[model samples]
Target: MHIAEITAVMKLPSNVRYEYFIKKVTDFEEVWGLFSDAWATSKDEDGNLFIPFFPKKEFAEISAEKEWALYKARSISLDDFIEKWLAGMKKDGIIPSIFPLGNDMAAVSIDVLLKDLEMELENY
Candidate 1:
């Protein structure tokens, strides 16, 4: 499947916010590569670097479940995205860990825009 946009907003324990974007990824592997590259290049406000988790089909599926319309309408919360959608993905082994970035009190928000790639991808 193809995705036009995926946005991940991470609110770290230190109250620092990090936003990651994935655009026009054609498959799960591409998503993994892009996420890895972004994490490798990312630095905190203090210039501390952190590693990123490898993207899996489960991660893509979690992204897919996000309703862009609802998010745009401001009807979703970062806590809901983590407690509901991401928690489900974790059960399915899509996410390696709930707190991959090591933020004890982190919250994640995801927004996804799906592309019609004629692959019968699932959307939630």
Candidate 2:
């Protein structure tokens, strides 16, 4: 069910995908990201490191390309995300790339993602 929904959502624009990412993560209490030797990361023009996350494993899996070719989709619990990952990433100056499809994504600050996730959780 969700797999099909995500497939359709993936075809939409990045902003819509980002909103779905937040909702699905909040609803499922899990986040998916690619991992191999270490978690996959990319740099913006300013050299800011970003770790892309998805609301579905299929989304993460599809993103595995080139440098991420050996990566596998890994799940992170929402509790860990809110309690540990977010703070650690904030301190490390890493941003979250939400629902990245191709080169387009919503790269948001840790604070913003934290707030959005918290707000989404409130709806449940």
Candidate 3:
């Protein structure tokens, strides 16, 4: 199975950093599909989709409040948002690559965020 780790960092209003990590066994296409659906379903008569301010399970790990807000407030198309988001992730080296061929056993340290954000994978 292919595993990807998603880390999101947000600077709250009080300067208290909020960081969350999500790890899942999914690929880029699946991730894209979720966002596409969200955009399509949320589109208004003006063709603008207002994305939620915070990360949700549907959207992949995303950072930067300004960029996200700008996209939503400006009514950027879903295509544009997807391209920009993917490009940014690639530029930052956060885009997960395809799983290695023939790798049956792989392990990754993932933060289990159910109860506490700081919880480690080993403990779970």
Candidate 4:
């Protein structure tokens, strides 16, 4: 039931831009978790610190349909929330590599590599 490789990153071809690699991870919670974890230095109104990143429990609370649209609105600047997360992933060295002609291939492969992919958080 476990795939250790889900957490493992592999090498992509050399032609794709790393930035767009960040742009394709539009699955809502995936983008939210990655970004929330990476830039979690924000504070709440009362000055108590609040991290946007979801815990496993919180993630489990999301429904696949709504989370995507909601998170997309919150996270994505151009294409989708996943793409934005891909940018964050690249910043954190989470993505392996990319190629020009193999852009679609690279994204698909990356998704395979991160096989723990779930849409649970997409419920919003």
What TM-score, over all chains together, does every model reach? 0.20, 0.93, 0.18, 0.21
Off by over 4 Å in 3: 1-77, 96-124
Compute the lDDT for candidate 1: 0.28
Arranged by TM-score with the best first, the candidates are: 2, 4, 1, 3
Q: Which ten residues in a row have the lowest lDDT in candidate 4?
A: 55-64
lDDT of 2 at 47: 93
**Tens digits of lDDT, candidate 1, 1-124:** 2343223333333223211222122232133311311222233466543323223333333422222112111122333433563455445433222223333322232222112211213321
- Model 3 score (lDDT): 0.26
Per-residue lDDT of candidate 3, residues 1-124 (tens digit): 1123222222222112212222221111122212321331122346533222222332322321332332321133333434564455445433221111111111121221222222322343
Sort the candidates on lDDT, descending order.
2, 4, 1, 3
By lDDT, the better pick of 3 and 4 is 4
Q: Rate the local accuracy (lDDT) of all candidates.
A: 0.28, 0.90, 0.26, 0.31
> TM-score of predicted model 1?
0.20
Winner by lDDT: 2
Higher-scoring candidate on TM-score, 2 or 3: 2
lDDT of 4 by residue, 10-117 (tens): 233332323323433433233333232233223334553322322122221231123232331123332333355545654554433221121222323336433323
Please write out the lDDT profile of model 2 over residues 8-118, one tens digit for every residue: 887899888888999989989999999998999999788989999999888888899888999999999999988999899999989988988878999888888898999
